[model samples]
Target chain A: MASKLDLDPRVVRSARRLAAKAGQPVVDLARSHTTVSVERAVLRLAGVQGADQDGIPWVNRLVDAVRADVGLGHGVAVPVFHAMRSTGVDDITVLAQKAAAGAVRFDVPSSRSEVAAVKRAAKRATGGGLKIVDRRRAERERLVKRLGDPKQRPWIYLIVATGDIYEDIPQAQAAARAGADVIAVIRSTGQSLLDYVPEGATREGFAGTYATQENFRLMRAALDETSRELGRYVRLTNYASGLCMPEIAALAGMERLDMMLNDSMYGILFRDINPIRTFVDQRFSRQVHARAGIIINTGEDNYLTTADAVEAAHTVTVSQLLNEFFAHEAGLEDWQLGLGHAFEINPELPESFRLELAHALLARELFPDAPLKWMPPTKHMTGDVFRGNLLDGFFNLVGALTGQGILLVGMMTEAVVTPWLSDRDIALQNVRYVLTGAGNLHEDFAPAPGGFIQQRADEVLGEAVDLLAKIVDDSLLTAIAEGTFGIMKRPADRGKGLDGVARHDDDYYNPVTEALEA
Target chain B: MSIVRPYGDTTGDGMVQLSFTLPIPHDKRAEGAAVQLANKMGMDPALLVHARPMGDGFTFFVVYGKVSHLVDTEKVQVVERDYPLLSAKEVNATIKRRLRRRLNVVGACIGTDAHTVGIDAILNLKGIAGEKGLEYYSELSVTNMGAQVSVPDLVETARERKADAVLVSQVVTQRDAHLQNTRAMSAAFREALPAGKRPLLIVGGPRFDELMAGELGVDRIFSRGTTPREVASYLVHALVGSSS
Candidate 1:
């Protein structure tokens, strides 16, 4: 993988340095603070299951009870384990139910030995859950080895979201047989806004299926069966973002999901999750993802949906560098980084195709080892199927020529309707044709020295360097408040879930975070 | 009477191809079931062309069929473009002369619909498909509330801005959310304001049926391919020109 764009090595080093410097303060802030979702995720790992009568998760109930009784500064683990020891309730779920019912009370241990015992018990209980996560990861590796990987360079990723778990299973299997290497069950609309994860299998959803644990298990089991039949292990993906970011990440890990839509700034900018809360939750979620051997997909593709891709090309690069820094800081390997970019330039513009190649090739060349997730054209899909299909063909050509790792199939009926099965078949045909025709085109394709593609890539890289310098000076939080990335201004102190953030006290303890850090 | 039949390859052939998914696996009986369903819908000579197992117990099918149903041109009902397609100058002049003030507009995507592309295309200065949006008009003052607005907030904004027209865009129509949100919005406006004082309600989306405006309790329904010029002209026709 030679540098097709001939990017300057000196400028790349400077940009990475600036990004690491700019992201350091946010990482420090995450280390010193914790969110309700992070603690709830810890409780989930400690084997707290089920929800109350109103469908609120038991983890949420237990966390709320602990936070109310003894403020969350010391974390929920100490108070809950103390209650468990005093009541002799070995089952964490039973203790959570009793706590939610106001029948059990939690107290911070007074003696030093008592505190040590409670900490050890908390660690041991969550350790059991981690063992299960470890086993699931091992199971996935064994299956992949036996079933074999997809016989393609760029894995064909497709989405099937029928709202019902039962319905999505068949559609997902159909997609796997149709040559999709990865099947992503899109989360239900606004599931990101819900503070608690939904429990059990769900039937009614607005646009997509709910990313419940039961739904995850169901889809994983079905895909495993399909993998055995097809002899190519089909991967499953789900969103581990929004208000319940860490909880979803933990669930994805326990269910052996291969990929998670885990991004740092996506929830803060798009879903309006508080910046502080998002940062804290994303850190823990990424750690979980790293441990589960899941490739985390960052949401830099979303920036182009709102801003003009040509004008905001530098922002995508800057965000990618920042996301890379964050992912590495969380202990993720280079192979586990599915960094995202999109083909969202207005096709009517002169030389739009050339501009797309420059941007895609820039991303491809910068993070050569990372599995760059190239997204399809979305903002310009105008319901004209014939023209839309042609636009997608061009998109696939660029993906093939640039050697992207994961390609989300572009639908001709994107803006018109949820794609019918025939629409998916036609879309897959477009992908297959281009990929087969130009699969090795990248080996031969190289932009001319000082040509338009090389110059454009250089220009975007230079702008990213300047932007990173400014972000370092003004601070990333302030830059975000001024709408630096996706043109969405999200203040640190504003947005939803800000109230859920708590600064750690001197005695703060979370066994899962401790384990993950270890 | 001018009558017409569908034409696939020949004129008046009444031939069509339909695709659908069934709950049963791909088998002979499933293919027969597809034909039976098509025949029930008046495709007398239905032919199953393709059938494949979608998953464990579901099947997808493509059927070629012919029906005797004919469409009478005179009996067709549609919501034609009833207003003139005015230029930007004409629209501004008419609004200024008729109302003696700038026409105020408020737009949003209500009820968990986060897509602001449609609303932005109509209200922002950058219009879709080469036409400038309503904000380009000198005699129009626009208030774009962006995405994920609630119905109550929309009504409050409309009343506060003294809006002459309130436009809403719904892009996520899964489970008919667009229809449900439109009905709820229109009902809220009706309850909050008197008939004469309430602002004209216009709902737009890609999936909306234009003929269902009355049924959905909105004053106008703008379907796909609706440009800002059409919306501005309709505002003049309904509010300004009607009074004049």
Candidate 2:
């Protein structure tokens, strides 16, 4: 797509170059280290599942036992595989039981041939799991082709969190009927802070449903049925982030989820997951997402919630560019980059709608092929339903005018209650009214020559370039520690999950990464 | 007498001042464009009163104009607060006399909501805006579980504590996560505890609709500017004595 705005191509190039420079060190750091979660992801891919009688997952128990014994530096693959090779046991559950009973011990591989044999054996064990993921990807392609795409630009995304997976099915189906193209099962609160993914289909959760393998399967199956009925392929979304980022991504891939909220900085900034741990985990997760053909939505929108949207608009742009770089490095195409931003500028701010237009249009133009996840207003909803409804109307109008790809319908009763089904109906109606009214407004509208919209976009881009340049000089870690991104300073060495991070040893091996790369 | 109109400088004038950013530099041309855009937006005789350069290419402007619109107040309906405000003493007295025991309240910022300011203001001993939080009440046992609490864990804590009320404070309503979280909480509590044993499911946030509480499966919804006293009194009224 040609540039719609009169932005200088050179400035855009400069911003990209600076973002790449800023992200290079973090990428290098991610490559050199592996967190406990990453190692657990490897085990999960190798088909180590089921919980002990205490409901603790076998993967967590295995990883905990491994980390406790030899520590994480040697990578869990080599030790677990070596144990399997030594004991002639092919079953991960049996190995887990023996390891739990203190009957088996892990020793680092001594020779190159032994390392090769262990990796080959590990790959042999996890080959079925990789095939399952591939099968899911193939199924998604088949379904998308069978059910035609939505006849619109930004797909309406809705969320359903009934805690029980069974209850969520009907709500999700109803949302699909209400014209939502994407259904994101919001995960239970504090799930991100947990080191282990819960096992099985959980019926009870707080704030959202548990992101279990069984739950993913159930939701995917239900969504497939809905997709068939709707004749427009309905997509599934989930968070493949937090402590077990890569593990969730692997699960999401196996379930054929269409999109994943896999941000690099989200855990570090919001959930207090260690920065090094998140950075290391995010790379492996993005790799899985890229391989699964899942569009990865970055959490730059969350930054605006903590930081001022108007003042920190450039930060969102800067993070989007960085997210693009990381996604590309993980082999994701532009279309797979669902970069996130929000309509969160204080509605009371003068020209807030105009500013929102500038920001949204800028994002659309910057990553023309990327599916931008445009979030709804949440920052300044004062509970007056009348005014809130009016604000949401303007928000929908901006989304239409800017051509956002994944439009989260804004609710008039936000910041209040779990919106009733009626609230979602009204919200959907609001979106439908504006969207149907001015769906093609983008084609007819262009910023006035040298007007506020164009000027704001350029200024934000310029500032992002400057910020990226400084980040490159001072390092991304330093900037994060200084609260540059979300007004939340997270140090590299501190915070949760840092204890799980370890520098990779030469003998380390991961069959999943090897298979995906191959 | 019943009809009302927006009065700025005079009755029914509908005079308004709006500010916005233009891509052009802060110059005469940009000011003219600002006025033109304002006029296009239904502002009659729009005048650019202020213009300033934001950056190299952007300019911000404040425009003054009159809108040819009248808001008929009588035709508008709002979700007004139907309950009366009760004092803290009356609330505690009502709970003590009716329930014959202290009220147990457990509150948390469930899900990914790390912002605990809202929760803290209601549950903490420090309170907000000089109003004493639930902890300051002698008849109320408040358990503040902090941020990022899961719904299952919250329900477990509520069950263990034998809570009379479960208060959830969510500051991050981004993508309706707060609302979704509340529904999940309500559902979990409903499924986990029997109706008679179930704690009153209460949620408070800046973006919540107080009138939609029953529909969201919650016992009550508290919006922004709700004081700890308001919550305490409401708890007393709903759980202990409806006539209070």
Cα lDDT, all candidates: 0.92, 0.85
List of clashing residue pairs for candidate 1: none
Native contact share for candidate 1: 0.25
Q: Residue B95 deviation, candidate 1, in Å?
A: 6.1
Model 1 TM-score relative to the real fold: 0.90
Worst ten in a row by lDDT for model 1 chain A: A482-491
For residues A1-518, could you state the per-residue lDDT of candidate 1 as single tens digits? 88788888999999999999999999999999999999999999999999888999999999999988898989999999999999999999999999888998777998999999999999999998788889999999999999999999789999998889999998899899989999999988878888999999999787899999999999999999999999999999999998999999999999999999998899888877789999999999999999999999999999988777988999999999999999999989999999999999999999999999999999999999999999999999988888999999999999999989999999999898888887898899899999998869888899999999999999999999999999999999999999888777788999889999999999999999999999
Positional deviation of residue B69's Cα in model 2 after best superposition, in angstroms: 34
Error of model 1, residue B102, in angstroms: 6.3
State each model's C-alpha RMSD to the native: 3.4, 14.3
Most accurate candidate by TM-score? 1
lDDT (Cα, tens digit) per residue for candidate 1, span B64-89: 98989999999988889998888899
